[model samples]
Target: MTDEGELIAGRYRLLSRIGRGGMGVVWHARDERLDREVAVKELLLDTGDSAQAAEQAMRRATREGRVAARLRHPHAIMVHDVVEHAGKPCLIMEFLPSKSLATVLAERGPLPAGEVARIGEQVASALAAAHAEGIVHRDVKPGNVLLADDGTAKIADFGISRAVGEATVTGAGLIAGTPAYLSPEVAAGGEASPASDVFSLGATLYAAVEGAPPFGDDENPIALLRRVASGELVAPRRAGPLTDVLLRLLAGEAGERPTMVRAREALTAVSEGRPVELPPPRRPTLLSPAPRVRRRTVVVGIGTAALLIAGVLIGVLISSPGEPSAEGDQPPVIGSTSERPDSGCVARYAVTNSWPGGYQGEVIVRNDGEERLTGWVVRWKLPAGHTVDEVWNGSLSRAGSTVTVRSADWNSVVRVGDSVSFGFLGAVEAGEGAVPELVCLPD
Candidate 1:
């Protein structure tokens, strides 16, 4: 029987159980050979199954070790070694004095927007690096995010993370992630992708700020799965500037969501209270400085090219002049300011997402002028009868027909050639959703 003070692998002495999850039990232990503290995870296996099944489980555990050991990031827990003890695989990892985000939320309730964004930024950075290595963190949740004693946040438990094309360790037809944070596609029997990880990250951050999961914390797992599979996520109430980032991350279609890298940038921008500018496209060679839009333009576009390279086709259209598309697949680019060589700043507006009676809009304020701005306000007239419902990443005010968005305190300064952005959801009448022009003033 396994008990405290028992020695494993002839060098590690088991102390006490520090954590328990679906996969295994994590014990705080001492590495007698190295004279250091470490975490030992005793992998649980089904022994009653056939010998072949047992062997496959063992192989899977070994493969997990190999896969996790390849990742080396400051925010990711390090896997030191893997060994077999009592006919099961045990993972030895770096031990840190920390509390899981799950425990923190349970004890502190909802976290502040800035604090949650900081946490999300760090965790997303690790996940982004992991994805670049072709590893997918299939189970990303609050329980897997660790808050270290030195105020650093690290992502733990990559045991369930799968490399591309690997067979699932779980039994046939079984899902691998927590229902509350599972992406809609995964909840509906689809494969987990980096996009799914973005969804799970969004759900984790959503829970951190809203005091509950996006789909609510239902008691029954099956019922929760049903709700998640339906893909109707509840809107966040307390997100404030964090709301738009969460919305983009929690997009229903996996392809609609941003990449983990872009998610990390967005979270970082929000945490700093600046306009959110997505990182530039990866393949600069495939894009033209001025490309004409048609019925279907197939070229390298922001947020679209990376997903294409990953084998997922996304319909992010940039419409030509005039009315928005009736399909409403992607909000059309309404208008932009004329570019001047040394202009201080310029504003461009696009309808990001739209529906029957509402739409989401984004404004990119780019610094093109010689002087840096300590503060800024962008103003434009909303179409007659249209009203702004909410805004994120900036403060909103109105004077009759004119709508003004001022930079937030944390994001007020504009550097040369850099950009900041804000998004808003608005109520609008059909055919009257277009804005005439935007004027930017730097303070």
Candidate 2:
């Protein structure tokens, strides 16, 4: 076996091992012939597997390179070459200075809604390209999502992929994919399709924002699989404006989930702090229809369950007595205040992250008036018990619920039509109205 500090194909020299998965080992290697760096994946075949199984595994490894090479997108991993080494297949891929989504979530808890939306958009776009090529990525999990240092998110791991109409590689009645991210139909031995990929994508992004899989992280794989198949998702309390889109994506039925293209569009809107709307399914999957379900007294999907569980979840999370929210759960609040007289600047307040009794809100100040200002300020009023926990991109000086923010040194100047945004983490007692009419003023 080739270990560290070895040469593969007499062309690529392995420097160090970077990652390992069930099917292969990835190494940080250099293409000596080309005088650049690249990642090399060595297929790991099971000796105990049947001859046919071993052959299929090798073919799958080669196919990964072929499939990825056909895709040319900023958010998709690039496949450089596929070569033979030690009588086995080695797939050469672009070396990205990045960490997996799983690593990010593990180091830091759930991400802010805006960041999650951006990640979801990039991954969804990559998936859309793969689906257009008739490729089905059976495995879509946080561990397979690479978040580049340059703020790009891309999908990885096509070892388990199969083109549409292709026979199963894992054999009949055998399931492939991580249990926590599998679609309901895939958990039931159904074929992997575009819809299934979308479902898996949604599950990954859900985990990104919720801090856990919707079904809860069951230690046992069997238990996790059962939860996914049964559509037992815990309602999200901290999703903020992403709740609607997240719920629609986590729908139990594959046909019910938005298409990858549609999901990408919706995620882009969310990331840009625009009005987020999920488009309905484009067309039902002809190859694999959604699993049929008989109606029951209680709805089995996330859509209805979210509405039913909102009140109870809110009450449990925000226990302090305060003014009741207008909607049962916290409905999305997106509004911009009128221009202030002094600086003629307008500020828009949008909540990016949230928790029970608390949230992370961003305010974007726009210069809508005549002359350019060197600096600007804004002020707002929160509920009686509400307080600012932290401020970013600006300086915060507050007197109880009345808070004022001054422009940061870096973003001091604002020309006409130019905007700069700042955010804060704040908490209010349950049932309290923390909405603020942020009015910009002279610095």
Candidate 3:
């Protein structure tokens, strides 16, 4: 390995080494052509009898670079280029001045609940996007997550990531991901799925909250694999809803595990202060609560007596035909006719409100269901005869028959039973009713 200030590929000037792993070294470098700093990963080529191994490593590096380059997401690190330097492969990625989650934990112990949730949600979203594109992260330990200076979570290190349907590259039959975060299926030599990512994410969250991986101490990869495969690890307590979520993700059977989308929803709910009900624990048969008996006879007697008394009262108080009815006994049922304008149509964070200028509407958002809302997207039509003229607190985008406002990234995650206020201005036409419909998307 070379020291800082060494030039690679004749153009990328190495500033300093940022990270090192089993496969290669990651360096902070300045790309002369782009006039910006970037991270360059360089693999060490093998010699002697391991020449075949070197060839395989080069191929894997090339493939990873290609795959990562194709994934474009706000939370994914961007791959710029891949090249060969000194007979070894190198990949250039977006340079970010951020600390790894592992570093943060080491420095500050556990993080606050809100901050952990925020980070977890971002990582989950990124995973969802990647999984939708047929990519499996394969490795999702805390070290792979980058906490950018701007507070954005950037997922990195796709060195071992594989696309769905791709042939397995870990031909040695050895496990791929860090043992602490390995999904049971992966530990047992099965193919990784979106679920595997979810499992690893759960392990990562466990570490974030409990300050240690759930598997604890058995650093030998094989031993860790056995423990994961057996599903014998205890969950972190007092971790709130996170504990439930991690347990589901770490289920021994892949089929029993929750989907990444579902996991995200659960985490979002926790972040938003919504209650996440875990399945009731099984109890001893002898200790079960006894059922209550029904009181049918007493109920029937009360109903019969009330009906007979009402019949006699009606016969005595009946008025003659055409006689005036007492206003006190019979009052007209009139429906309310007052039309009140809605004034709650404004967008919160992560949502954009595109109502026309001068248009106003009301939005009543409730954590109606038990689940928490990590984020939401609302689209509504301007009331007939009224056109939206202005909006606030969110960005707005409009198309024919609909105006969509997305919540701001910061406010996208909302808690259960919590409500947000948003309003917009629209030109009011005579007799035009403006009602806005809101759709909440859970994290």
lDDT of candidates 1 onward, in order: 0.70, 0.67, 0.58
lDDT string, candidate 1, 1-443, tens digits: 16999898999899888987656789999999999999998876644557775666667667877888899999999888888888777889999889999889888988999999999999999999999988788778898899987779999867444322122223332223346787766654444678889999999999899887787766544445546655666667888989888878887666568899899999999999999775332211111112212111112223221111111212232222353543311344554443342456676666533344665566667776788878888888877878885665579998887898998765578898776666566776645545557777774
Highest lDDT: give the candidate number: 1
Cα lDDT over the full model 3: 0.58
State TM-scores per candidate. 0.60, 0.59, 0.57
- Model 3 lDDT per residue over 304-378, tens place: 221111001111111112334342222222111101112212222211111122222333233434655665556
Model 1 residue runs over 4 Å out of place are 159-177, 278-443
The residue-level lDDT of candidate 2 at 157 comes to: 63
Error of 1 at 166 (Å): 15
**Model 3 — which ten-residue stretch has the worst lDDT?**
306-315
lDDT of 2 by residue, 27-114 (tens): 9999999999999987654434466645555565666668768877778777888887865677888898899999898899889999
Q: Which RMSD values do the candidates have, in order?
A: 17.2, 22.1, 26.1
Give the better candidate number (2 or 3) by lDDT. 2
